[model samples]
Target chain A: MRLRFRPVDTSFYDLFTESAGHLVRGVALLAEMLSDTADHDNVAARMREAEHAADETTHSIVKKVNSTFVTPFDREDIYALGSGLDDIMDSMDEVVDQILVYEVKVLPPELSEQVDVLQRCAELTAAAMPKLQSMKELEEYWIEINRLENQGDKNHRRILAKLFSGEFKAMEVLKLKDIVESLEDAIDGFEKVANIVEQLAVKES
Target chain B: MRLRFRPVDTSFYDLFTESAGHLVRGVALLAEMLSDTADHDNVAARMREAEHAADETTHSIVKKVNSTFVTPFDREDIYALGSGLDDIMDSMDEVVDQILVYEVKVLPPELSEQVDVLQRCAELTAAAMPKLQSMKELEEYWIEINRLENQGDKNHRRILAKLFSGEFKAMEVLKLKDIVESLEDAIDGFEKVANIVEQLAVKES
Candidate 1:
């Protein structure tokens, strides 16, 4: 069997970068909602809007994948990137939903810090995605993404430790713990995106 | 450039099947432990042993992946399978750890049922793995695995709804909620293994 070689189109790369940017924007919106002192319904509505936008962006990428015969990266890589990005939005949406439904009034300082780390991690992930189209120029960004992920992990540990300290009331503890876990999950999704980008860098190199 | 086609050894498939079998056994042990009225420490110790065994099995698979020149599936597929199987053990271990550390005395009825479902999911997943080595022989089992996953998902939703019904005390509710979520997570891991097996079936077909 003869292997047909064709350079992957630049547009697919652009779509992927766009998707990553949307994910970053979604995380930023989530952070803003978390930090907000407004009514619960208002914050939840904003987070839901962010999730809807991320969903639309993911749909766009999927449509491109369905129509294109060739992709800039492996088909599985593209799917993973799309799914991983969407997971970040889903995680945020879940946290927001829980907060609103439970009417959780107080936010733990530790959980607040985790959300901040998650926002920064998403930003780094978004920054790294564009560089993937030109792997040679983006090698340093991959390293930076890894560093940000490590920082997120550290924050996760700190938050978990505080949750187990028996300081907060049981209900407060449960609410804060779930929020922290979801934030960590969002960061994990970002880390997966970075891992895929690093794999792309290796393949390109 | 000529693409080199290296034949995959059957032994790796065998190893994965064996590792999956170990995971099923672990889930079974967990279900039994959760149902038992025995000493909490003993139950936790048993769960820890199963997790350690699964970890060792995962390490073996990783070693095989690193040293083997040819693989039966894509490298990413192998990694996904390895990690997916390991996640089951990790999730179960975490649940048991939480139960023990939190001094949780009473288990929720619905959560126990989910544990049963998780055990069955793991068993079906293990059953499906050996079939991937020769996909034609076990197509029916692969379908069954998917059906079982869907069933597990339904059970998860039902249990989660029951958990938040405002029946239990605040601390009790929190503990039950965490356990239910953890069990669902374990089932999700099992479903992921089934998914990978289904993917392999597709490739083989």
Candidate 2:
């Protein structure tokens, strides 16, 4: 029996960038949902719909990974990138799920701030994705991504510290805590993506 | 101007694996600290020590990455793996730090159980690291790792459901929730390591 090797394809990169775009869209939907003064059920439904879209995008990437022989980058890198992107979506979905499940009616000011930062992080991540395929362009975006990630981290620490202060009611604190942590996790996911792109640039150079 | 390429050395792989070993040890230390009925300050110190060790390990890997011309795995994979392993350790440290900061006295039953699971997951991750260097051996351990990960997921879901059942005191519920989520995140980190190992095996085959 003879073994065959397939030529590497760049399709995985395309699919991955597409998935990142979906994540950005999902986060955008979530931002809108959070901003609206809608019923909990309606907000929950919209959040679920956004999550479903992210899941579909994730499935597409997974299928591409399983079928592709040659990937533009390392197969593991592709998987990491895919999983990192999915994690951002998952973090957003988890926050919405918590809000609905806990029957949380009010969003804290701190949580709103975290969500605002998260939306910015998602936007930056989506913008950076297209530039990943071009190493020259990566340098331009990579520094910005890192700066945004650091900003997210600072926001996370600020919110977390405020969460522990004896100001808010117990339930309010609990709700805001979860939201802050989820937002931080989502930003961390974006940072992971940026890290991968930066490493790719290093490898290509 | 002439460009120079240095020959790839085994040092990068050596440093990465060594860093992985350090991470596994850090997690073990965290688990031990969690299970101990030690003073709060003592536990916090111990956790901090583990974090510092893991940070030192990360520094070593990063230094090697900066200087190395070639790596055994994708440079991004190397970075991802290193960062992921460090993340698991950091999450473990964070859990312990929270316990101390929050002045938590008794361990939640669910969180204690998850710590045991995390220990097992870390051990599996450590065992898988050497096999990653030899891709042919990865498949043998892949199933076991996945099985363990599934078990961790089951535990996560079970505990989370219990959390929502209103069985514990409100403050207890809040603290335990954070600890449980962190433990589950650590397990997910281990599962990520397994996933990457499986990908490496497939690519090698």
Best of the candidates, TM-score: 1
lDDT (0 to 1) per candidate = 0.73, 0.71
Error of 2 at B195 (Å): 1.4
lDDT of 1 by residue, B147-166 (tens): 77678788878876776788
Error of 2 at B23 (Å): 2.7
Any runs in candidate 2 off by more than 4 Å, and if so which? A1-167, B1-10, B59-67
> How well is each residue in A123-144 modelled by candidate 1, as lDDT tens digits?
7767766666667566566667
Q: What are the TM-scores, per candidate, against the unseen true structure?
A: 0.65, 0.63
Spell out the clash pairs found in candidate 2. A8-A70
Model 1's DockQ? 0.12
Interface RMSD of each: 4.4, 3.0
Model 2 residue B189 lDDT?
Answer: 79
Candidate of highest DockQ:
2
Off by over 4 Å in 1: A1-70, A79-83, A86-105, A116-120, A123-182, A198-205, B1-10, B28-70, B74-80, B109-117, B120-128, B143-167
TM-score of 1: 0.65
lDDT of 2 at B57: 76
